[model samples]
Target: MTLKFGDPDLEGLKFLQDDPLVITPIIGNCHVMRVLVDNGAFVDILFHNTFIRMGYNDSQLTPSDAPIYGFNHMECKVKGAIQLAIIIGEEPREATQMLNFQVVKAASTYNAIIGRTGIHTFKVVPSTYHMVLKFPTRNSVGEARGDHKMAHSFYVITLRPDRTGGQPAEDLVPIPFDPLDPEKVTYIGASLDKPLKDRIKTFLQENNDAFTWTVAKMPGIDPNLITHRLKVDPTRKAVKKKKRTYAPDRLEAIKKEVEKLLEARFIEEVQFPEWLANPVMVKKANGKWMMCIDFTDLNDACTKNCYPYQGLIP
Candidate 1:
């Protein structure tokens, strides 16, 4: 009864939240994290600052047995087993895979979490009078781009240069922002006649498919179900904040040989899809292709919020 963002609720696509709840995780091959399908959330994850840029070390965190809520509910304080690997829903399936290692953090963003004590051992189902959320087809995983693919969620268009007196407006400007790195879509303006940077490099070499979209209307809440609250920013005491400026054996040797320029190495250390820092790979056979980046220097050092394509368009 509260899902508005482009409009299209024919009873929430004929009530289908039974499985395929929008979850993603793929560490070495890359896809990092795309969480949504919360199974009741008890204490599944919390890593934030990109898990310290992924080498995680709050003095080698170790303090959780289970229990650390604080999204305003207040309780905070946890540091338990975080070995890794919850791969989920697809890939050489072995019960959709599991090996939490020992993740323990209540509030999230560190790029790791799947709470409800592990979504109540996979039996989570929720519709909320058609808000949508259900996962229980033998603990569903893989092949679930459900809800017409979350109604196409990948917004971020920041291209500006509609100058008025400063001189710089040859027809190339558009703005839209969300950018949590959902498969990417950040243009931040200024390609001049470069034509929206050639239509954002042909929308990442045509993969997000025509990037074809028309659903306009998102201010807050319900872009296909949203639940938020996560913060962990007040550092400098985890051993004097790791003795000054990030180090955990230098990010574990930069995450054990950081040489994965993404071949679908979908970059995911807390969603690095800020476009791409090393994108430029090309290889394909039956299933493989490259060209995915639009981070644009962390969206030009962040801070320009978008939304300026209103009134008319062809």
Candidate 2:
């Protein structure tokens, strides 16, 4: 389909063509905001701050020795790399793709950068002048509009020398509970005094049970105390999605994970279910395959909770 930006695309955008096209796209399970669409970049990038905030551990990153240079031709340290599912545009017209992103330690106003690689992968036609992106879908062209105001705000932040470092307000340093197994560790405020840090580390080690190191260590909540039920509409017809095939290696990983869950009594086999969904394999930063269920049909049939709890109650 022919994709073109018109006057409607420039409705809310200012006449300033200098503003970068920044869009918010669903990356993995998070709706990552302030993602710069830099066509000049050679690869997609995920900033370290955003990666940590997304609940990922540094150990999850796949090792990469290769380095990448910035626009200024200066070499930037590569933290590692990760693959995540990215959805651009809204449903019915949206396109989904698993993209490899280089995670960088450098701080930036933006959480991620979708570069030329992503643009080509999505077959997107981007118009920086209109601050919009269009890509071909199954039926028609899908559109992802950029936030001009947010882009300008970030631009201003970049100009500020005090804020441009992109460093977090508070830095965290990792402290391993078991020196033998460095993988089992936790983070503490880097600014803390040496004595305070030692005390905190000791406290954590003493109460190590509080930290779940593996799935086997997880003591699941009792259903008697609290249980969740899907408010599925009865009128909605059940959907049985077709089974999806996976690579042999991914299939093996899925099998192993499923077995582990089954052994832990976390999941049980159900025969001849009315509504069925296929499992999706998402590659983790650690080069592991994570199985996820496609619950779109099930979610569509469920009613939204308008009065969700706002905060904790005594």
The CA lDDT at 226 in model 1 is 73
Cα lDDT tens digits, model 1, 275-302, are: 2353333333433343333344453333
- Every model's TM-score: 0.20, 0.51
Count of clashes in candidate 2: 0
Model 2 over residues 1-314: C-alpha lDDT tens digits?
79987888878765454567899999989999999898878899999999999989789999977678865567888999999999999989999999999999875678999988999999998887788899999969999999977775553355333311234559999988788988999899999999999999899989987887778668889999999788898988999988888889988988999998987788889988999998888776567777777777886576543112222111
Can you give the lDDT of residue 109 in candidate 1? 22
Q: Return the top candidate by lDDT.
A: 2
Q: Native-vs-model 2 lDDT? A: 0.82
Candidate 1, 19: how far from true, in Å? 3.5
